[model samples]
Target: MAENTCVRCGAIPPSHDVVSVASADGSFRLLCSRCFNTEMADLAEVHAFEHPEFTPVRLSDADGVVHEFHFRSLLFGDQLSLEAFEPVPGDDDYAGFRFQVLGDPRSDPFELLGNLVQKMKRALAVKHLVEDAGHLVVAETTVRGRIEWDGNERDRLPCVVI
Candidate 1:
């Protein structure tokens, strides 16, 4: 009877489940479910960009001309940036575009992507009537630069007024 330690977070009595992952050398490393799932999700995100199931998302412009954008990486943060390969008409080289999702950092990145895919599907079903609506929009105050998730307004005060 010995307590197992999670190699990733070093949690003795793990927050929840513990899983064993085999290394290349055939040794196993124990990790709590949170750490293991986070690692798996990160891998999945990488795979989605590297080997996307859907390629060349087609959306029509106001002029009804279709534009294709190849799937690219999703940069995660308070404001998520989705990069794609967009080929411009009359342009020989393929260009890149970044569609941003501002605010709502509380939402999981994967969940946001899922919601976007759902919206895209709905828009496509409607024959692309939605104009210039490729980006995900969240209702929150847009702030410039990096957002400090840990800090509060009190931390920014020079002095407390009486």
Candidate 2:
């Protein structure tokens, strides 16, 4: 058995928090949690020309009604593009929403989405309509909400937006 070292810092990470990243050539690099966070932060500044696989997210209201949305792609700046199929019957097209990632760029995008979903869950718990340009809303919410994107959902997390 051999110990893995952080590819960026060349230091050993704690057993619980090792992060692995795959390079363009298909080689893998291990990083300490700190180095991984740093790399994610740097990613925020650049456009992701190559899209990564994203999982769909499920959000529930206080009444136990669930809505599913899939991550489509990343746009310029800190915005993530998403699409939600109409949970209702006979609705063919997908509804779109632009989620603006706020706060520190050092946070993982998935983690940020999880956090947002948690916020929305809380709002739904209180019987509040979770609507906003930066948050989740239907096309009728505003002109911006009408934008659509094509893709499938890759990951699921519990989240809510305040």
Per-candidate TM-scores read 0.29, 0.36
Off by over 4 Å in 1: 1-54, 75-80, 89-98, 102-111, 114-162
Error of 2 at 133 (Å): 32
Task: Please provide, for model 1 over 37-118, each residue's C-alpha lDDT reduced to its tens digit, 9 standing for 90 to 100.
Answer: 4565475453332212234577664356566655433323223433333455554223222233332434455555566555
lDDT of each: 0.45, 0.49
Model 2 segments beyond 4 Å from truth? 1-50, 78-89, 92-107, 128-162
lDDT tens readout by residue for model 2, 48-122: 333333556677766787766544323323544322222334532333222433433334656656666665555
- Find the 10 residues in a row with the least total lDDT in model 1: 142-151
Which run of 10 residues does model 2 get worst, by summed lDDT? 80-89
Candidate 2 TM-score, true structure as reference: 0.36
